[model samples]
Target: MSAESSGGQTPVEYIQHHLTNLSVGEGFWSLNIDTLFFSIGLAVLFGWIAKKVGDSLDPDNPKGMQNVLEVIVEFVDSQVKDSFQGRNPLIGPLALTIFVWIILMNAMDLIPVDLLPWLASLIGIHYLKVVPTTDLSATFGMSFSIFALIMFYNFKVKGPAGFAKMFLFHPFSANNVVVKIILMPFNILMTTIEEIAKPVSMGLRLFGNMFAGELIFILIAILPFWIQWIPGGIWAIFHVVVITLQAFIFMLLTIVYLSIAHQSQDDH
Candidate 1:
């Protein structure tokens, strides 16, 4: 057998190559195919599980998956009700979807980073990134979706005129004509900054955490075999908690953003 077919590449070289994303374009226009596929697949699977659990639930007798799902539903329901004062059927479901979908995506980190890609290479497909959150595009896409939802809720709850008024005079004085004139430009600048910062920060936060976790995993994979197992095992165990917490935090923030957008000025 050839050297290539003998012992094969070192684990470090194998993992480094796999971590690279399959991109289709340049800069911001670029798309990570692996991240997109894994994220969508996990989201669909979780959605199906949620539906099945709901269907299986019986008010008369509930246990196991049904009971766990009911608890999650109630928890999310209470959060939506407490934060948003409006009759929106969409809000509750949307929040639940975000929570479940994000958790499922984050859970992908629990799998061995090199497992699927290594298996794929056996069949001639070499590159695959299993953790979607590590992809900037995936996180940004989620945040952008939340941004759209915020705008929709803003218009739905406040109306065009009310939403416009918020931009003109918010978190500042527009009480007098002179004050309004002075503050209008500043208010617009601040409001614009705030709106832009929300989605960017939301996306970056998730991306940063996941990317760091992935990097650490890569670094650990590169260690000498004698020392590799120790750090790799420890980080993987700790990362299970980190990824889950990050997903939960991201979901909660989305709910909070929508809740804030839906509130009337006086409610603040």
Candidate 2:
């Protein structure tokens, strides 16, 4: 964005505006409209494309979109096979969804930072952040969903009694009953922290990377018009790698976590 687009606002103000969300409601109850809009839109598009590809698959001779999607599906399935244990059919599709959906959300950073916001401005929408992965709510929303799935499969595979036993008795087993009882609290504390760390770290890692990348793009947008392309072009190229790697890491971690959940403590 040029200085002209700032409309008398300072550089800091311009950055702040670019970073702000079109949000509503109060505090935790608030929703980020742009984040939701782009994320849900991309998800629907992914679903439609997958449906079309599935409906039209030809084993005799696959080409074009079929070839491309099969590559992605097969790649995701390979990852699931490597990382997921036991038999949960959902793992394959869940990993694929996480990989591609996050890639779509992260790809929003590749858009010119000012393009969508400026377009929205023409319609009186002053604030818009297009990269949904940069939004904490979106990242954490996804991470927490994975967390729920981990819990579900843990219960499914291990049963509540087994899960409770693993939770309460792991990493501190003792031959003496008294010693085992003494270590239960510490085991519980450690287990809680590990479980919380999975989702918290997952969410923060995605949000931090995308947010920093988007901020750099916004900063590039505010540079002198004649010189903006140098940095913008360079960062955009590097960011393509960053976005794809982040999506892959997120997917891999989800698989690994679920695998752990599906295993007995003895298995671990």
Candidate 3:
């Protein structure tokens, strides 16, 4: 897992070391510095590319970088057109940002596992994890943000009374007051579980897949030098699809949830 001198460290220790994050705090206040560092760095990279694209965009004379940027924009726009409903100017850009940013984060897995951490050690940093998606905090942070947006859109589109009505009457309802009262608790419970599950499932699914992929890469690195390429190369090729798919799935689900949130009960 590490290219550094093993110093009699066991394989388990090496893996744990690779998995560990460099941090400066303890317990509840601890931050995964590596995840924050890489995630923010990638976000800045995305922003820079987006700015360049915007500054240089020319519909009449598109070529080279402009053409490539236009293709990416069209691709994200098409995805937004397919999944999102209703007129929301923000959704298109939001979807594009999510897709490109997530793909970049996922793409960090392609880096040599030991390269960054070993380099960091040379500069006196002890631990570093380059793949942000592998960290639960990073994944959950993104999902939670999406969840907040869903909640906001729900309120904005439905109004207070309609939003409250959705929780009180959804999944089970009755005409009689007493019957409705009897079903209210069940409805609320089911609705709460359903709402909470969205972010949990989204965050966990991404984290689980990336963590497994990262572990496989680590395991591959542990193999004999000559034989490592066989499995490593194969998994690396397969993982390119996985990283892209996870990003697309995240973006698709975000658009779907937002679309659902933007719809009224009457519309449904």
Candidate 4:
């Protein structure tokens, strides 16, 4: 069954409406305004809260939000310390930021699908996508940033000669000069594919999970209001676990990738 003529929108149309981003610009340079706004807004919110907690922190008398914030900090720090070896000073803070930012973005899925869109409608905005992780461009943008960092660390730790050797002589190197020449192209191709796959996989994984979750919520929204609660309530309960797990996976992979980059050739 489909929703009855919601402002002339069919069930499919309603879902599409919810999925559309409030975008600007055109073609290759287009920007999803809603995704950017919500993501940056949530990140700023987290920083403000963190700063307040830090300024007011009491060692012996931690309570309320202070205790909660401390727990989150310790948890992220522990994860980074355990997984990251030969770490930079930035790893712990980076892990914490990624974990918190992703959680906040994923948490947007828990909000009622129509609430924000309906509210935006009242203000004359037709489209407003609240969840940033559901946007592939946003997810890919983050993953590519991480990928660039990985590349930088690769060069820094291994040096240019060693990094170049990673591609040239990896996986299928030959001792013979002629044989090595024949294999060089193949080796480089495979290595390049492997390196590129990391960020593509990371970005797509988060985007796929979040997009599916958002789709389910939109589907629920088109159902009768009273009956909608059944699936909506169950999905909402289950999604808390999903959101947290996705954030943890992203953080853990980041630590592991950086750890691998920091390793010397002999470690493998």
Candidate 5:
């Protein structure tokens, strides 16, 4: 913690302050301003940079950021090509956006944990969380948005009857009409649980991993100033892998989920 934010607080207090957000209002109206600020700011910046770099394509001699971006685009496209069952023009770009945006947000955790909050405190903003993936609200927001797309594709590919078939006939079909009727409620219950589990698991997994990482950084910060660099340096090195893997896993799962949605029961 900086002199401004840390003040005379105990270690527990310091950690609490650092973990909290610059929130306002309460209940349904509540908002985490720092989470919104950083996540949206990074997204806008990413888009602007990508658009500028994209519009000035020099395929003959790509270099610097263009080379790096080309690598990332190709990597994301390859993953989509592998994971998605069929073709949807949107999947490649969506995967690229999710991967890069999440990686950018997760990268914020590498900033000396106290640095941004300290700076914010200097400007009279007391609480700030730089990492959006560490926040459940933000993670769930993205996951549920993906979940919506999953539903959309399910409808788009399978139609209303297909959805009903899955709900009523999946995992318990029968030649006899009476047996199929008997299994409808069970199939619907199981299918409902399966559907709910997807976004919940996805959101919680991202939140849990990133929150633990952030907490460790905070704990390292409260250590003796002189020796903090030892563990901090090691963990920062390892966290590069953690942040990148988290982004990739989220993006891959999104592709997989959408691909599954695109398949009809007969395809299964």
Candidate 6:
């Protein structure tokens, strides 16, 4: 059938095409092809540039991309130093990774929501989500990775027994042994909930914002050509700021959560 004859490309089809990620498998096992490629590609590119800038540091003169990268590196270094007290070779790199990967994912929203999908449809592959942050799986995957890092640091800083004790007794401990025993389960439950909430909130927050933005863009694309440009242009401009701010916020929160998790029991 001709393109228009097949239900004239309904709104549902439009959205389904955009929301679908190019994947390798079925159901939950499905991978996000675009997200994986784009995130990794951007990480490598940004990392190489950052490293080159650092190695070629000129005390006498700094210009171009080197100058911009230096400011970013210095800012992130300062933040890591200010917040995380202990020695961690990983923290600075992890923060930079989060910042760059997320910003690149968010930047996909600027690529005209329909453009990539339209190209995909022409090739007989009907489903694709160009923006990785709009995919819950991608967002959660990143957040949970960060969560793993946080847990690692917690155990590394506190020791396994110390980390276990924090969860078992925690801020609700009692001096009496019997009372402490009674409250142990409750404390564990609370701690479990708190730990679980961190990754859930971190992932959902980014996913929700980007997904909502994508929906708005799709809705705008549905409007008449003449009127569509007005709202679409306005929202696109506003969304540039939104996407960047969200990336920065996600990075900041990741740092904050890691710092909190690494805190000593006495501090809590």
How many clashing residue pairs appear in each of the predictions shown? Answer: 0, 0, 0, 0, 0, 0
Q: Which lDDT tens digits does candidate 1 get at residues 1-268?
A: 1113224766556556756886678987888888888888988898788779777768899888888788888988887877766676787888888877777787787676667776777987667888888888788989998999888877777888778767778658656899987887888788878887889999999999988988777766666657768887898889888877887778788888888887986664
lDDT of 6 by residue, 1-268 (tens): 2223334777777566567777898887887787787777777877788778778888789899877777777887887887776666877888877877787788888787667776777988667777878889888998999889888878877788889987899758899999999999999999988888899999999999999999888877777666778888999999988897888788888888888767886775
In order, what lDDT does every prediction score?
Answer: 0.79, 0.90, 0.88, 0.89, 0.90, 0.81
Tens-place lDDT digits, model 2, residues 97-116: 99999999999899888889
Model 6 score (lDDT) = 0.81
**lDDT of residue 251 for candidate 4:** 91
Candidate 3 structure quality by residue, lDDT tens digits, 1-268: 4333455567788789889988879987899999999999999988897789788788898888778767778988888899888889989888888888888999999998888987999999989999999999999999999999999988899999878877888888889999998988998898889988999999999999999999999888877677778898999999999998999899889999999999997774
- Candidate 3, lDDT over the whole model: 0.88
Worst 10 residues of 1 by lDDT: 1-10
Residue 234 local lDDT, model 6: 94
* TM accuracy, model 2: 0.96
TM-score of each: 0.88, 0.96, 0.95, 0.96, 0.96, 0.89
Write model 4 residue lDDT over 1-268, tens digit each, in one string.
2356358678878888888999999988999999999999999999999999889889998899998878888999999889998959989899999999999999999988877887898999999999999999999998999999989988899988879878887768778999988888888999899989999999999999999999998888788877889999999999999999999999999999998889875563
Better of 2 and 4 by lDDT: 2
Better of 1 and 6 by lDDT: 6
Candidate 4 deviation (Cα RMSD): 1.6
Clashing pairs in 2: none
In Å, residue 195's CA in model 3 sits off its true spot by: 0.6
Give all candidate RMSDs, comma-separated. 3.3, 1.3, 1.6, 1.6, 1.5, 2.9
